[model samples]
Target: MKHLTLLVPDGQSKLSSIICTYKVFLKANAFWKNIHGSDRFSIQLAGISDEVEFYDGLFSVKPHVNISKIAKTDLIIMSALNNHDYPGSISRNKPITDWIVKQYKDGAAVATMCTGAFLLASSGLLDGKSCSTHWAAEGTFREMFPKVNLQTNLLITDENGIYTNGGAFSFLNLILYLVEKYYDRETAILCAKMFQIEMDRNSQSPFIMFTGQKQHGDEMVLQAQSYIENNLQEKIVMEQLADTFAIGRRNFDRRFIKATGNTPVEYVQRVRIEAAKKAFEATRKTINEVMYDVGYSDVKAFRDVFRKITGMSPIAYRDKYNKESAVA
Candidate 1:
């Protein structure tokens, strides 16, 4: 079993940080447990200070595990500190950066979550390395760390020994990647299943397309959204929807844009594709079964739509998820 050391912050919101850190720990533990029973991995918490209190009325800090031992651990994860109070600067603490750099030089894999990337960038550890953070913090991260390559599209980036994930819920992607690496793809799938979370495994993949944002001139748009949701498994034509909504085709198009931010066809496709994603992740159904359930009649058409929406074939999606489950 590999040892993971989590470096938690001290002060207000520390309780929230601890909660997030524990989630990460539980995810990793569950992932490996699915693979190798109960005795798989271990996590040790090394608090920066004795204990910290949160304004929201929460307190957290695991019992003392010496700071030096943390450095020796195989992996180190830096959780996000208080983003609101920290401002645009990388971090208020310079020694934290130095310690991280030293750990990297010593051959331990270092990682950070959300704005924790700021700490890594400030340490110069991510210099010239492609990294990402939550989209909300893109501008701040870019301006503060010019040397590091900022990649905002990915949920997580694994650069050799360094890994960084966007804040919020992107930590799942990081944990999934770790599961896949140490165990296998099946393990990752099992982890995702346990959490009831689903995401396209590929960063370049497009799991959804919104076509309706063209031009809105009516109430027909929201009606279109409702219609698509109701008829996801049926072949939907634009004229049919317009006639059913009791409006002219051109007029329906204009109203759909106004109500749903997408055109009728766009809305329909989005609904079908979204349903397909759910079916792919939740069921062991075959590709053809999924394709038909999502309303595509021809296997070829289903493949095309699946590829267009997810950047992967339907079979690939099923296989990938299954592989992750097995690995987990």
Candidate 2:
């Protein structure tokens, strides 16, 4: 039987993440017994805390074993930390993080859910590997772990037994993924059916809200972003924008990218796409109309950019999101 440890971190963790994952794996174990007449997994909750409270004391979790007591595990799953103070969260959970590192070094696989990637990245294991996290935390994750490749569009990133999933509550897909890996395809499908979760969902792109990265405090770059947002329909010439700011074109591009995490060109595309997404969600605009409204006149160019960023074509995005469009 594969030994699984669901980590209960020392700090604020999404209580649902730990509870739901535990329940699913337990169901998987029972399903395996029905198929093979034997248990395929052994699951336990391990933590440093005797009991952890959550959501202002609405719930509490007591792990099956203290992390220090469990010397070996076949798999270790870290729950998402809801706290924002990354440095402080990591420092307080040093023992837990160190334990995770030790387990991985001793031939165990590690997986993190949502912002749980923070703890995993801090362990230096994801130093050169790719990871996925909540889209809203993209700036913070990038700034902290420049060595770790953060892919926000992908729902999951699996490399060398280190797994990560994107955003809140999407961790269900990761659990389903793990079930398929450790148990069997049939059992995974059954769990998917039981939980009513859409299976084989590889992209989290459609759910991402592209609020422009604005944390970097560059006044000129901030003004440039506002200009782009205000004039989404206008032809935004990068060089002309720089001239309007009275700064050199080259210097303008440099500051814009450094502050907003996108070049002047890419920023325009994202803002336009974001506007297009909102239009598709809230308005019944036809694909071509929405395209023109977002400043893309050419049909092919708009479709390509929409798919490149959102993982779906214009009509597909509209049909999936807009009730009126779909009904029509």
Candidate 3:
């Protein structure tokens, strides 16, 4: 049997992630027993404390085993941390982080649910590995773990036995993925039907809300970003815009990338696409009408960029998100 350890992390962790993950693994084991006449997962909640409480003790979890007592584990699932307090959680969970590092080196595969990526990333096993987390947490995550590759567009990332998924509720998708990988596709599909979770969801791009990368303290880059966002329908000439800002085009491109993590061209494209996404979500505009309003004149060019960024064609995105448009 595969011994699965669900971590009940300390310091304002999401109670639902721990509860939901525990339930799924237990159900998976039940499904396994029905199919193979034996249990597949030896699941347990392991944490530093005997009981971890959340929301002023409205909810609490009592682990089956403490971290220090477990010597061998086949898998580890970290519950998501509270978005507003992950740094504090990481600092307070120092012992847990250290234990995770030791456990991973001892051959236990680790998976993180949503913002749980922060704790796993803190363990240093993800220092040079690719990771995924909630798209809204991208700014803070990038600032905290610059060495780890943060792929916010992907719904799931699997590298070197480390698995991560994007944002809330999306953790269910990762659980399904792990089930298929270690257990079997038959069990995964069974669980999917039991839970009513859509399967094979591989991208979180359409859900991203880009407000422009403005976390740095570069004043000139800030001004440039504001310009790009304000004039989303314009055909921006980067070199000319650089000249207007009283900097050489090359120096401007260098500084823009350094501050915003995107080149001037990519930044402008994102701003335009962001506007297009909003239109699709909230308005009843046609695909070509919205495309032109966002500054793209070529039908093929606009469709290609839309699909590239959102992982869906314009009509598909609109149909999925806009109720009025879907009916139309």
Candidate 4:
């Protein structure tokens, strides 16, 4: 377990709506501590100023401490800047940016929430690194820092040591990611329950291949896809799936094909291929091991499907990604 520190700018006067971010962080911290009590992860509030001031007319306290002199930490998080939420000139504090650069050199994993990416971009740390911020800030973020690879749709982007998340709801996603990294899925679930929030264990990965296309299509087809993602490694019978939806097998098949342009069995195979690809990234398991885990008992049939959809054998695909990763 490691101690994490959060540094707040001194002249900021008071914390604003961004405190919602810290609240979520504390809740996630408590959950992880409870699960792994002894030698568990911890967070400390370090302010940049000694005299705390409240935002005039707003009920928030000013943070009081400089980024320098903070203790060693495994992770450092920069909260969203309130004014950056709206369209305006971005005046990042130079001192803050300089401190962040120094911390990065000290070997701390850096991350920002929402418009906080603005601060990171100012520091020149996000150069050539893929990052994400609140969807609304995409235009301004790009205009200010064109060198940073900005991805708007993702909840979070984990590029090597730096991790950035979209603001607001994404703060939860970021915390859940931390939980999953240090703790386990069960602990993350309990932490989410503490806040009465639903945690997505698979948010980092694609949920369904046709999520964008299916959002505008038939609801039945969407349900079918959801069922398939949940049961990828299990035996699936089209008849049983249709029965669950209270539709005749023929009608269900027609709707499924119309919405996704793939038959039910075809969709399942596609999912199996995706699973095999992911498995290949982790284990040097043989094609047979990959196929059996993804519900294909017959090795020859799995190889045929792999070649048909991927245009390459399983070994070839694995070797390609492996070599690419190594070169990278």
Which candidate has the highest lDDT of all?
2
Q: Write the per-residue lDDT of candidate 3 for residues 1-328, one digit (tens) a residue.
A: 7789999887778888888778877888898898799889888899999888888888888999999999989999998887578778888888988988888888989999999999888888888888999989988888889899899999999998899999998999999999999899998998899989899999999888888888899999999998888887888999889998899999999998877777899888878888998999999999989998999999999988888888999889899999997777
The lDDT values for all models are 0.67, 0.91, 0.89, 0.68
Give the per-residue lDDT digits (tens) of candidate 1, residues 246-296: 889998887665454456676676677767877777777777787788788
- The candidate scoring highest on TM-score is 3
Sort the predicted structures by TM-score, highest score first: 3, 2, 1, 4
Please write out the lDDT profile of model 4 over residues 129-170, one tens digit for every residue. Answer: 998887656656776787999876566889878888875556
Name the runs in model 4 displaced over 4 angstroms: 10-39, 51-57, 62-65, 85-92, 201-328
TM-score of model number 1: 0.56
TM-score of model 4 (CA atoms): 0.54
All candidates: TM-score: 0.56, 0.96, 0.97, 0.54
How many Å off is the CA of 111 in candidate 2? 0.5
Better by TM-score, candidate 4 or 2 = 2
Better of 1 and 2 by lDDT: 2
TM-score of candidate 2 relative to the true fold: 0.96
